[model samples]
Target: MSPDRGDRRAVTAGFGALLSRYRTKTWLGGAVVAGLTVSAAMALRLALSPVAHFYYLPVMPAIMTTALLGRRSSVGLAIVLAIIGCELVVRRDSIADTLANAALFIVVAWAVAEACFRLRAALDAAQTMARDMARRELLLDSILTSTPIITLDCDGRTRRVTQGAAALLGVAPNGALNQPFETLLPGFGAAALQAAQRSDGASRTLWRASRRPNGDAALLTVAAHQLPDDADPEHTVLTLTDQSQAEAARRRERELNDRLSSVWRLNSMGEMAATLAHELNQPLSAAAVYLHTGQADLARIGPVAQPTLRTLDLAKAQLLRAGDIIRRMREMISNGSRAFTEERAAQMIRDLEPVVALIGQDTGVVIRIQTDDEDDHVLADRIQLQQALTNLIRNAVDAVIDRDDGQVTVTGRALGAEGYEISVRDNGPGIAEAQMDHIFHPMISTKTGGMGLGLSVTRSIVESHGSALAVSRPQGGGACFTFRLSRPTESEIP
Candidate 1:
């Protein structure tokens, strides 16, 4: 092939390659626009041929086309316009002028195309930024609407709540806006509100609020944060979290602990039963020997004096009573089947006083027993009732043992026509507030070396008999534990 033909083919290939770089649709649209622009420029030139020059008019269309379509299409449009201008306006004799005119048009078109490209790039960047901003806004809205926590924006100066504060106050969002924050949530304390307003920088203030709505009490944790410097300085962000469920869970945990402690107490009681049996056996054996010896002497003496016979009978009766007491104690240790009977409240107290006195002797705690009604009668398992009373008395003694005026009082009072209430009160340091809710729980003890099961087990025993055991701080100083036993009616007493 000839070198001139080869160079022409290579140039054509390059031009075709450039055109193919653009989409097919763009190329077609550019072609149509270029043709119309050239036709308009030529017509304008022809009409003004006798008058003046309109050289730069065609460049405007090329620049605009470049911005709308692309650089490649604008180049094609510029080339076509340059050709049309050369033919219609330039003189045939002045070849240099014609060439210079064509070159000027091409250069102007290139400059305009470059400007269009830059302007197009700037616009595309702006569009991308707008889309990103829109996506971020959507994400923020989703979080605000779906989160469980209540969010609010408040004005620092007026303490007025704004966005996201309505859900906590149980009001419409629009209605809550511009309202005083305290009015919306009256549970919040004035001190906390004042502190939140003064908070600055990135620090946060935290406080708690309590409310009772519809007879249900709820606890909320409030957190306040300061907004950025560029934002309104008087604006603060507040968030509230409901803690009612957490408090309930804590109560359940305490109850479970109490049950566990009761189990531990049972285990300990089982271990102590053998020791108790051995201690009681010695007294019973001695009493039996005395009775047998007395009988033999009386028979050998051929009928003793009436006073001596009476003394022997009394001794026999007392021994039998001691044996009964021992058997009852064994039954309590075993925690066997209950046997309920009509029993006088005063007699029950008297029976327990010896044991209580022994317990208080070492600690110098005086135990006083008082009965409001000697006729107060209840149907109860005698041994089990005694054990429950024993536990309470022991706890009361321990509470007051350290005081110089240590005293524990056990009182039995008849309630109107229904039951009898027994209370054990002490003059000692009262229960702590932190331990109040969990005192009956197993393994929760305020005393050193305490297994924390006494109250829990006592409560279990009392509740098994259709009653509840309660503890309270007395008006004067110490703790009081009380329980009630239902009494039989007059018709059922006999």
Candidate 2:
């Protein structure tokens, strides 16, 4: 059952108990008040006056008691009043007048009691309903306090969590105070925590963690959600839902992303194949000429011609190199590309050479590749980053391809004490002044037949890997697209 429903039941039960207690008190109090007031009036009439004067005592107390006390008590009070009136009549020869007065008191008391009974019953019912409502309110409060959720502020401080949080987090009751949310939900890592804290409105994310509660052995799913802002600003609200179903949803999402990423990579390769084929042709042509010349020389002379042998060896080596380049290009287009991990940054760069080659082939634009750092890695999804870099290089090539002296340079180096910076600089018409702001935005392509998602996808990949990408005009001319990947510390590397 939902916590809310459970609380409602508790409230109803509590209200019923309260109503019963109140009704009992009301009934008893009414009876006592009626009895005391009547007895006092009778005593005063009998003790302080002449014998015949007993009939002069007021009948108001009897009537009032019947009115206030309701049917049963009111009726009983009337009987007592009647007996007193009868005694007075018996003591004197005024029996007719006394009996007449006693009968009048009895009739009045019965009527008042009947009216009081109906009114009192209605009041009692109302009181019970009021009690029930109050009980429900209390139950709602309890449910809110006991729910299994939490909210946090930007300062890494706890703002709210359900009363059941202690059980959810395995902390002592009320011990969650001032605790950093990430301490409990390790999956919220620094970036995710920051995103949640700085979010202006509602956002949802599913997280998976193998961390168990302090005193329990079971793994918990911590569903982290961010509340969005409407017109007014408010503190970010983060709720950690249960781990079971949310984790399953997250797993499915990741799998779907993986499949789509694969399709995208293949599509890119297909698009660049024309250029790659051209790039491969140049090297193959050079090796073929050397082979043909060496064969002619060998036929003119014997099997071993000194100069021809050297030339043949050089041609053989070039062919092998050309074959290696072709293989790399083929691998880049291969359907099965999931063997790489984001944990190896250097390997990621190495794996991107073929895509770069393909771009060179497609555009006939000269690309100078240079790298000064090695044995480095970063936490990044390798395939995604590869796609991003390919897109950027493709853009740079496109930017420079139309120029007579078009040139693109791909460079990677360490940014000293911070991260690794990779840049693709081109020497063609730079981004237009009006289009700079939208350069990395999706569907904002500068080229006549370009899809604008390349740069946008590049930025997404860089950011997802906990990095940043930017655009600027290179010092000499054209545009430069630069992205930084934080250098992995020793522990993060091998």
lDDT of each: 0.68, 0.64
In candidate 2, how many clashes are counted? 8
Q: By TM-score, how accurate is candidate 2? A: 0.40
Regions of model 1 farther than 4 Å from truth: 1-26, 36-52, 71-74, 89-93, 147-165, 185-218, 228-230, 245-266, 288-494
Root-mean-square deviation of every model: 12.7, 16.6
Clashing pairs in 2: 201-227, 201-228, 201-229, 202-227, 202-228, 221-243, 275-361, 275-362
Give the residue spans of candidate 2 off by over 4 A: 1-35, 42-57, 70-74, 89-101, 132-320, 328-397, 403-424, 428-494
Error of 2 at 303 (Å): 21
Candidate 1 residue-wise lDDT, 40-118, digit = tens: 7567667876797666564466445544454566465656665766566655567787777677767777777778666
Using Cα atoms with residue i matched to residue i, what is each candidate's TM-score against the true structure?
0.55, 0.40
